[model samples]
Target: MIVRHDAGRRPGYPAAAAVFAVGMAGTTLPTPLYGLYRQELGFSELMVTVVFAVYAVGVITVLLLAGNYSDRVGRRPVLLTGLAFSAVSAVCFLAEGGLPLLFAGRLLSGFSAGLFSGAATAAVLELAPAERKTRAGFAAAAANMGGLGCGPLLAGILAQYAPRPLSLPFLVHLALLVVACVLVLLLPETVEDPERWPRLSPQGVVVPSEARAVFVPSALAAFAGFSLLGLFTAVAPAFVSGPLGVTNLAVSGAAVFSVFLGSTAGQSLTERLGARRALPCGCFVLVAGLAMVGASLAVELLPLLVAGAVCGGLGQGLAFRAALTSVAAAAPAEHRGGTISTFFVVAYTGISLPVVGVGALTVALGLRGAGLTFTACVAVVAACTGTYLLRRPLPERNRE
Candidate 1:
């Protein structure tokens, strides 16, 4: 097992980040397959959102209850536990017979993400060489957006061209999970206390006192940005396959991947533009992307849809990384994990609630109309956030 010696040597940060990426990839593996599930199970669009929402619920629950578990136990143990959840999630998908199993699978995946969001991020940062701490930020963002982008691409390709579409995707993911687990075993543990394990108890989202000022704008930006992501992740496949008549899962997945790929690219650029500037700019760009998405839905243009995905995803990456960096930097050292957890709790809420609203809206007014409504709502939020940030600028020096 890879263990870190506290003798001023850096642990294997790249390997740890890779493990984080693989684990995250498993979380979104079902993005393109939702259409298949709807056809096979005979469920409504609302049901799809509900199923997706369950994953967020699981993530929030874990963050609230177990977000700081790694600090007490150790990063490796919590990460391994998260991988176990990922394996179980893959199994649930592989064995899914009905909605219950689907919910279970998503819930398990959410739990895995919740555990990972805190533990893996901290591990990557801790493992970084002192000189590379700044780069560690990009590494974490890349692992996250890159992993998320790859999930849909992988599942889409398999489901489109391979036999046993649903089953094959899960099988491939399970194999990857096994590899990730092995990698986790080889990752150096960063937490100092091995015997200081605290009994797990529900600690509702721990927002830091010092971070309160930065948290508002940062979390708002994240909320708006994530709402855009939620739109694509939950319903884009249905729009492509149902309304637009694009039936290929691989194509659908590629479309989804475009947005996340853009997000990864946007994250890479955050270093050039400071966090403060990146936050509002991301919101504005996100609004532009949403406009393109709305236009695509109205005209049924595939290219427009792709553009929207890429643009919106880029905006999300910029805003999200900036928000995370600011929040983490402002948070007190002792409460860093808890504060980050709190930020994610809000971010995940953005991911879940708005998507659920869109799903519900779809029931009354078809996908196109519902999408328009979503676009309108998020645009308002993004505009408000951008305006607020501009009117009241926070200290740029807060960036670490």
Candidate 2:
């Protein structure tokens, strides 16, 4: 949310956002094809989440280590580096030696995403003309979530309807990455006189005393909300194919995409609701979505599962945006960027760790049982936070 201004900046946020979207799309390209991998490579359910979790680990590691790298150097170099990682990730999927290649590919993909997350957003925001700043912000958000949502859908359609299920999805993505790299080449550098190769400085987590009250609940809400995303990308396809009786890969991909679409819709409401109110409101909606997910698992109903994806995604997006805004406002301006970086560490942790737990549960409880348990626990966390927030909402007094 903190954007630096330089004189004579170009007006190309739309192009920057397009670059962001293309880069992110590669991150989730493997979602719908997990089942095919399991059938061909013979890995367990737990392995699926582990593969997904590796990407999160990569992202978190990069965020902690070089999260401010673009600020020190420049956005273009970081973006190009991200695209390069993305291309390699696609290549790993294409080679498909075995599970090892899949994990390596996912880790590389995570590295690309980690680089893209901070740098691309800054690029989009900094590229905007003063008059279009607000719209640019929305464009950045849309590209992030919308691109993530599209990955699964695009993969599903290609894998199901087109040739070479595994190879084709990534092949198409590689082509798109080429386009993104070209776009990045065209974008003007936003950082004024940025170093070509600055020394890397890790930005450790920081939660100022004034922001703790706001940060704790906001982080918890994000943790609970992102669990659904982990569930969908890592585990939902198997659920759809097995219990829900839907074998169409496109449908499976669409199911995953639905949540992200809902997330995008949810984010659109944040400005209207105000960040302070949107956080708790999002938590309540998320809890309701979790309930539906649990019910879908219990009854084996496809419609309810789809419904849960939408509602839960909506809640996640709404709470996440508000959480970032509220915490940044509470922090001192000097520490604001570090504070936001810390927040993303927690959010990505939510998306990664709990998913592994669900995969572990699958061995003992079966997919449906594990999903039901996951939903119940997350719902309780969200509900408690929502109730607490209702009594004591995030304070706007500290907001700048």
Candidate 3:
């Protein structure tokens, strides 16, 4: 086996993970406050999802075009640039006047996330101690989910109790980004060569022929899983306030947080049950959760909605982590990054496109009808995916 010389000696792993968490947190900070934007701006539900989709567009563009930039120019530089984008994104929100500003903020946030997904993850892994690889993986995953969970939580608390719901969260995020930048500067450079910057071009989805069999199922599972996340992040609050009659911003934020928190908890379960078991198991739970959500929409019950969020979030976490593990192990080392990028591209598509469909359906179907329709469709897809995985489980040798 190949060994890394500085594996156990590096001190930047924790710092990099912290920075990663902060940046990811910034991307979702506006989630709970979308309703306020709607109230002030007089925009439609379709516009909400359209704005969210724009962020995904920015992320996919960056992943395709500059995903490997850190591999050449060095992690610190790329991360700093990402942080800069984060700062600009915050400024966009802070200066928001109309739809254009909101769109700008979200797009910049997407750019920041695309950069973090590659450079920060690589930096965290590189800085980790060799024997602590498993722990590092957990750290990175937790930082991602935990940070995402914290965003709406923080924004909700601030929006409900603090002044300027639209303004405070971004301001707080800007401060955190500044701190993250300083920490990044202090971390030792992980990349060995800084002079070998290659001519950059879009490296769109690169799937090696050998990995196709497992990749299809993995990508499908990811797509289904991320759609659950998309639903909660994009419009769960609207569901909460509009149909369920819950008007507290903190409660709305908490609802969103619960899904992500459940996801984080589900990810930990992967270690116990293994990815093979976790992948299908997650889909089943997700389907059940969707069922609950559909019922809640029909009956207008907040408790059922909350219950669904927890259960579905857990399922998503479990399946998402398993999918990542399975795909990573199956991929050729040289092509791993691109393969994973493709997986995320599918996942992000799930997050964007389906939610936008929900937005479109809302015009004719109304919120309850739109919600019921959304849940039914996603549940069916998840059920089908789960059944397929159960029927053709990954080979025993490949599972961890």
lDDT of each: 0.86, 0.90, 0.88
- TM-score on alpha carbons, each prediction: 0.94, 0.97, 0.95
Q: Which window of ten consecutive residues has the lowest lDDT sum in model 2?
A: 1-10
Task: Please write out the lDDT profile of model 1 over residues 1-400, one tens digit for every residue.
Answer: 1334342433377877888899888888999999889989999999999999899999999998987788778888999999999999999899877999999999999999999888898788888877888788678878988888789899999998999998998898888888888877877777775645668867777777778888888998899888887777788898898777889988899998898899999989887888888888988999999999999989999989999999999898888888888898888887877788788888899999999998999989989899989998898898888888888876776553
Residue lDDT tens for model 2, 1-400: 2345552545388889999999998999999999999999999999999999999988988898899899878899999999999999999999999988999999999999999999999899888878888898889999999999999999999999999999999999999988888888878877877776978888899888878899899999999988889899899999999878899999999999999999999988898888888999999999989998889888999999999999999998889888888888888888887888889899899999999999999999999899989999999999998899889988866332
Q: What is the lDDT, from 0 to 100, of the residue 239 in candidate 2? A: 92
Q: What order do candidates take by TM-score, descending?
A: 2, 3, 1
TM-score, cand. 1: 0.94
For candidate 1, the clash count comes to: 0
**Candidate number achieving the greatest TM-score relative to the actual structure:** 2
